[model samples]
Target: MNARKTWTRTLGTATAAGALAWAVVAAGQPSAAPTSEPVAETGPGYAIEDYNYPGADRILAEQGIVLKRGDGHIVLADCLSEENLLRFLARGRADVCFKVTADEGFLTLEIPSVHGVRTDDSVNTHLAMTAEDDRVEYDIPAKTWEGVGESVDGREHVLVEIRVTK
Candidate 1:
């Protein structure tokens, strides 16, 4: 079971975007809300969906990707897996980081933790990007990031898909 869990999380940062397109898998979850909001900006883009946090809190926490600034610490999971992450991006300015482990002994795979760039508007109602360049500042709205994964029991699976809008 350890191998399975490892591979699952591994697909997170790597293939964070590309692989998600080709496969249909159920992701884990995220972390809980801050009970409030962070009061500083560091990375570039970030915010907090306070009201909705409790609903999807488990998903983010399980993902385990946290960032901090001063007396404030915000998890990237706190922003992702939502309809509107722009608020968090604008406020948190989080530098996205992700990690997903896999059972290396079972499968051999090549997934990018930082998949190039693509126009992903499949999730109707969410125009993640109006264009493909400088996602922050809402200029080009090009999103970029990466993921990590591994092979296990002869099957390739996903761990996480870390995406940053910048």
Candidate 2:
């Protein structure tokens, strides 16, 4: 009977020790329950557009011209700002001028009722104009003035755009 009681007590003690060691290990481990929502899968994103010209709207509103996008080579110039510039003569409007800042530049603008353009000698220039049913192009000689629109032909033309290479 003494041996039997000692064996039962030893078995109980061993079982208790095993259970305590398991509890200690479980407490040290991270919880199985999630603490935050799983992140959602996303698709490919899109690219942004950045092709607008700065101050183009104001120029259009104030000058009655639509100055569109360009490569930052040609810009509007105050007629009195400089002695040498590409000048244009418009019907019933003051002359307009553009200053070339780089060795090569291109501009897209609509100047209505343009009759003539004066070119600067420093840069080779080209002008495009539109009439009722025709598109006209003119190669402006360096440092010289050229006639366009009604001045050249009976048809009145609107100056559409200009390109300059220095």
Candidate 3:
């Protein structure tokens, strides 16, 4: 008699649990709602990273600097904005400066007739430029101004890339 009662209780509990699970699953299923409009399929698009410089067209128009792309650690800045800036000199134009926020940085740009680069106090800088069909590179020490590009060879060189390490 005790065994029969135990079996009966177990069967009842199992049936209740099964019914509860079925109710939960059925509740999750889609049902007809009182809507007259069709569902739209549109949504916000995905985000993508292209690495192109922001406001590049505006800066090119305003400053004549052809900024291409970078890792965002190095950026164009006002020459007089702060000290310890990476300064660049180009012929037929004013000196350009950049601010470095990290221990390492990279920027690719085009500045025609670049002849000199001044490194900040914290980073050793490497510069790459091109003149006609030849490529030129310079390694500049921290807190030093080094003549690069056309200053060394008299050929007009376009500054292409700047890499710095602390």
Candidate 4:
């Protein structure tokens, strides 16, 4: 079957359970309609990457990558080699560049070619849309709702659409 429909069906099929499982950080924004214009690529000082990855101190400490994921907390896969681990922890990137983070009241994940920024509360929630495998040839050309996320086990990732906005 087509990937889009498949993904949609998979997500749409789930109701409360999926929302809790995905745990998007929409921060209870209610997935409102987009009011802002497409995020400009060459904005003033820096770029989208900067805004996307502000820091990893809090999240890193929280996950405790050095240790193992026992329960309740998330776990990153051992896909990283010894060399890659050092690079990722220090600089936070690999040729694959998968990231996990949480903000004031949100949790997020970024994958190799995409990004997922959602907010959540202690209740049920899901993303407004899915753009993970949608074949957009641009850098998120405008900000249609999408995301890149990691799995609970952190063994795999969902590199939702990103870096395609104009």
Question: Each model's C-alpha lDDT?
Answer: 0.28, 0.84, 0.92, 0.32
Q: For each candidate, what TM-score against the reference? A: 0.17, 0.69, 0.73, 0.17
Order of candidate numbers by lDDT, starting with the best: 3, 2, 4, 1
Return the top candidate by lDDT: 3
Steric clashes per prediction? 46, 1, 0, 18
Rank by TM-score (best first): 3, 2, 4, 1
Candidate 3's TM-score? 0.73
Q: Where's the lowest-lDDT run of ten residues in candidate 1?
A: 102-111
Tell me the spans in candidate 1 whose CA falls farther than 4 Å from its real position: 1-50, 65-117, 122-166
Candidate 4 per-residue C-alpha lDDT over 1-166 given as tens digits, one digit per residue, 9 for 90 to 100: 5999989877877876668756765555577676765456445644333223233555456543222122212224343432211012111453332222221112234333223332112222232112344322222212132232332222234332221101
Q: Tens-digit lDDT track for model 3 on 1-166?
A: 9999999999999999999999999999999897664344455566677879999999999999999999898899999999889999999999999999999989999999998888999999999899999988888989998888888999999999999998
- Pitting candidate 1 against candidate 4, the one with the higher lDDT is 4
- Model 2 clash number: 1
Q: Residue-wise lDDT of candidate 2 within 82-139, one digit each (tens)?
A: 9789999989889999888887888888888888888876998889999998999998
Error of 2 at 162 (Å): 0.5
When 1 and 3 are scored with lDDT, the better candidate is: 3
Instruction: Indicate the TM-score of model 2.
Output: 0.69
Q: Quote model 1's TM-score.
A: 0.17
